[model samples]
Target: MEAVQFSPPLGYVFDPTDCELVGFYLCNKIANKPVPGIDYSIPQYDLYGSEEPWQIWNFFKQRLGEERDDQDLYFFTQLKKKTSKGSRIDCSVGTGTWQGEDGGREIVNDNMRVGTKKRFRYENKDSDQHGGWIMHEYSLDQHSDYVVCRIRKSEPALKKNKRGKCQEVDSEKKKKRSKVQEVDSEPLPLAVPPATSRTAPTTTMVQQQIQLEDETRGF
Candidate 1:
């Protein structure tokens, strides 16, 4: 018989170092919230480090078309660490310039502490553009072992519709109005009177009185 060769293991073990960062931008409304900041940092590692940075940057440049000095983009990342029991994770945010090498530059910041939140401001080097800081507040118990990051372009002030003033529509009013209209449109049925409305027939006392008068006349 031939001796059989044995293999130690078939698959690779999980490595913390092998893990990659991923991130996304929060919606304009929620961008200031804590979750977005934590979530936005992950993609930076995946986007910038996974592939050649320059190649990705070149591709981004072509897609973007024109480049400007005043624009900014933000993202977040989650850091995974190996532990005896399991993996531990933390969240962070990456924000900075966009366009050239300097444009790709980013700043990674710690996420808001549980029960406490913070906001960041962006300053434009150029004075001609309208630049302002965004405010973010962290929700309670929002932090976790996993991190979530969000990115968004600075938005202009929102304009309200000029045609109508905001008014709340109530279902109760609609229902009541419909009931009133139905009552007004339809005619009511005739009502019948009760038997009590007529006078009681001549009482038994009157009949007795007539019989007594006849008896007295015969006498």
Candidate 2:
């Protein structure tokens, strides 16, 4: 069968929870059943090959552009045996390796155990130092050879708190602008006409004075 290629719309993110990854995507995939949008959302790739994590990140970054800088990536990769008959798997990628952070954890769905998930950190093979790249590996309890992986860069807590503060500041500025706009939109009070001159003669009075002056001239 031909493998399905996934090409998401701009700004689209593939972020499935652990239960969804195992109970839904993985189960249907291993059973040869058709998953509605999996063919377009998640693609099979050689994640353990020579490509580093950043290279994978850059590929999506360039394809999706900066608009998707926060997007998470997912892939379907099969485990590789280290020997002809051994249980060990080779997880080396390029010049770095994925080191497990803790023991595997169980993923439950609908009050039943569905799968297991494990966290791994990418470390430089030479220095053995970890980076910001983190991955969550998910696998079915019934099937372990094939698994789904979610990878993303870890964000610093300080940066997240700073962003929250910035958002609050922006919200306050918007509120002030809205109030100014409302004031500008309101109609100004009708300008009161300057008090009419009290000494000015009325039109009827002026006409009477002209008549009296004509009568006096005639006499």
Q: Best candidate, lDDT-wise?
A: 2
Model 2 residue 69 CA deviation in Å: 2.9
lDDT of 2 by residue, 71-148 (tens): 777778898888969999887877888888988999999899989999988877343234557888999988999998
Clash count per candidate? 25, 0
| Model 2 lDDT at residue 34 | 93
Query: Which ranges in model 2 have alpha carbons more than 4 Å from their true place?
Result: 1-6, 64-66, 125-129, 155-219
Clashes, model 2: 0
Summing lDDT over every window of 10 consecutive residues in candidate 1, give the lowest-scoring window. Answer: 14-23
- Candidate 1 residue-wise lDDT at 31: 42
lDDT values, one for every candidate? 0.33, 0.77
